[model samples]
Target: MTIGGHLEELYGLPAFTFPGPGETPRELPEPDAVAWRITADSYDAEEQWTEAFARFCSAVDTTRVRALAVGAWEDAYDRGPGDIIEALVTARDRLPGLRSLFLGDMHSEECEISWINQTDVTPLLSAYPALEEFGVRGGQGLRFPALRHDALRTLIVETGGLPVEVVRGIGASELPALENLDLWLGTSWYGADSEAADLEPVLSGARLPRLRYLALRNSEIQDEIAAAVASAPVVARLEVLDLSMGTLGDDGAAALLGGQPLTHLRKLDLHHNYLSEPLLRRLRETLGSAGVELDLDRDDADWDEDDDGTVHRYVAVGE
Candidate 1:
């Protein structure tokens, strides 16, 4: 249920964390479909993750492996994912069936989402051409070089603060078969410096023809993003549009209602927002009549208004 945390499942695969030195390994029903996670015990533990990865590769028939979820690497706050990525790339020939990959699966206990260091992940997509789904959490030092992956269907980037380079890289890159793109555009307090112009390519739907589900969640500038997405060519073809977990207020909701006809969408998720009761009622009255599944969970409604006349709109994840 939590973003930037350990995923319960991915691509229809139940998550299975690999056993550590003294830990017990549970019995896996469908081993091939299991989303195997590898991690080091402590952040400062040296060379443990590589050892665990090696042990996993030796024990499991990786040729049948479909999903890989990389948990905390040794000293994840200091060390980056370069070595781990190379190790996976080295075993690409062995992992002929790998389709789904998730990097930086550590939760707050290991490292804060914004503190997790990452690097250019273009190699993973380049090496594994047949990959259908690729996801990564944490945006610090994260990079996605310009590249096209024909078979990729789903791409999810969950970050406390998504960097501008990554956002532009995503827009510039070509994903012909991509159907779902979920981005948690967290606040700029960490590193999110992306503006509306950066998403022009993505919003234009110039390259992503198959994209049906688009989520621009967990943002501080949710209203601006909503206004942009209102006129986005991609929205017309999308089956689901998610703008949840943001600082979205009445302005964003009004822009959405006024700009586009969202009756064609299968669902609209605007949960964890700061909308007023009247706006929520209007959204329900409008979208509900069209049979569109509308989610207007506004737990932050009262929290936005400060003691003074000022308002404090914020995203779900700031740390």
Candidate 2:
């Protein structure tokens, strides 16, 4: 299974799993959704692909295709934004009811998460105003300008290095009904320039009044982010706060432990971090007593030290 699938299972997300090649697709009735995993490898050698994507579009009742997952589209001929995106946009009239979309749904076997090329996705919001949930896995060349989409409830941008421009765009967006926001602030080498200042709007607790889940995760600067999130006014209203898959260390964990009134939160995910054993134990006891599910499942590798004993940490999944 893919990391995404595993994470969905772990978090109990309402995800629609896809079938393997040649397996029968899942039966999806009204209100429920089905995911179409497209791959260039599916085409036969002698077959013409001029109608390749079109076949999938025609096969599925687009109206019933609420959750569309794109996988290995990068291998499609003349790889660019226009390939599958154009097909979808042209079929928008037939997909009026489509709500959720997941792009770059391939695991490392198909394409490494960091290598999945993406373009500006703001056009999707314009094409599908009814879209409630949208997720993109890769960050390379990804761009999402600030745009108003009233029905959008969830926006997830997973990147090895999310650009600051994208961060600013999200902050400037007018998602009145946004409920869940997850941004993987990857390593600086991958163009992740967003700092605490760029995230101020989200942390203010005023921008998206309906927000309940916030994940500022997969960051090289998780400790700094943790310090900021510890005091963010939004924490009081959030149901789940994830700072996992990062370099959150003792200082960051201390900030979260000693600060924040997290008794009301439903879950706190701090997996794959640099938290010490004692701190993790204390955190478990504290959050457990408060009825908050804590995930400190994976500890960081032994800290990197130089001759002088200066320690260093790395952001999980940034490489």
Top lDDT model: 1
lDDT of 2 by residue, 171-264 (tens): 8888889999999998887778889788988888676989999999989889889999988999999999999988888999998888877889
For model 2, the stretches where C-alpha displacement exceeds 4 angstroms are 1-33, 42-51, 75-79, 300-303
Query: Residue-wise lDDT of candidate 1 within 1-319, one digit each (tens)?
Result: 2343588997798998888877676665455868999888445675578788998887788889999999889878886889889999999999999999999888888888888889999899999999999999888899987788999999999888899889999998999999999999998998999987888899999999999999998988899999999999999999999999888988999899998799999999999888888888889999988899998877654354657878787788767
Question: What is the lDDT, from 0 to 100, of the residue 125 in candidate 1?
Answer: 94
Q: Which residue segments of model 1 deviate by more than 4 Å?
A: 1-5, 24-30, 300-307
lDDT of 2 at 264: 90
> With candidate 2 superimposed using the best TM-score fit, by how many Å does residue 199's alpha carbon deviate from the native?
0.6
Residue 88 local lDDT, model 2? 71
Q: List TM-score per model, in order.
A: 0.95, 0.85
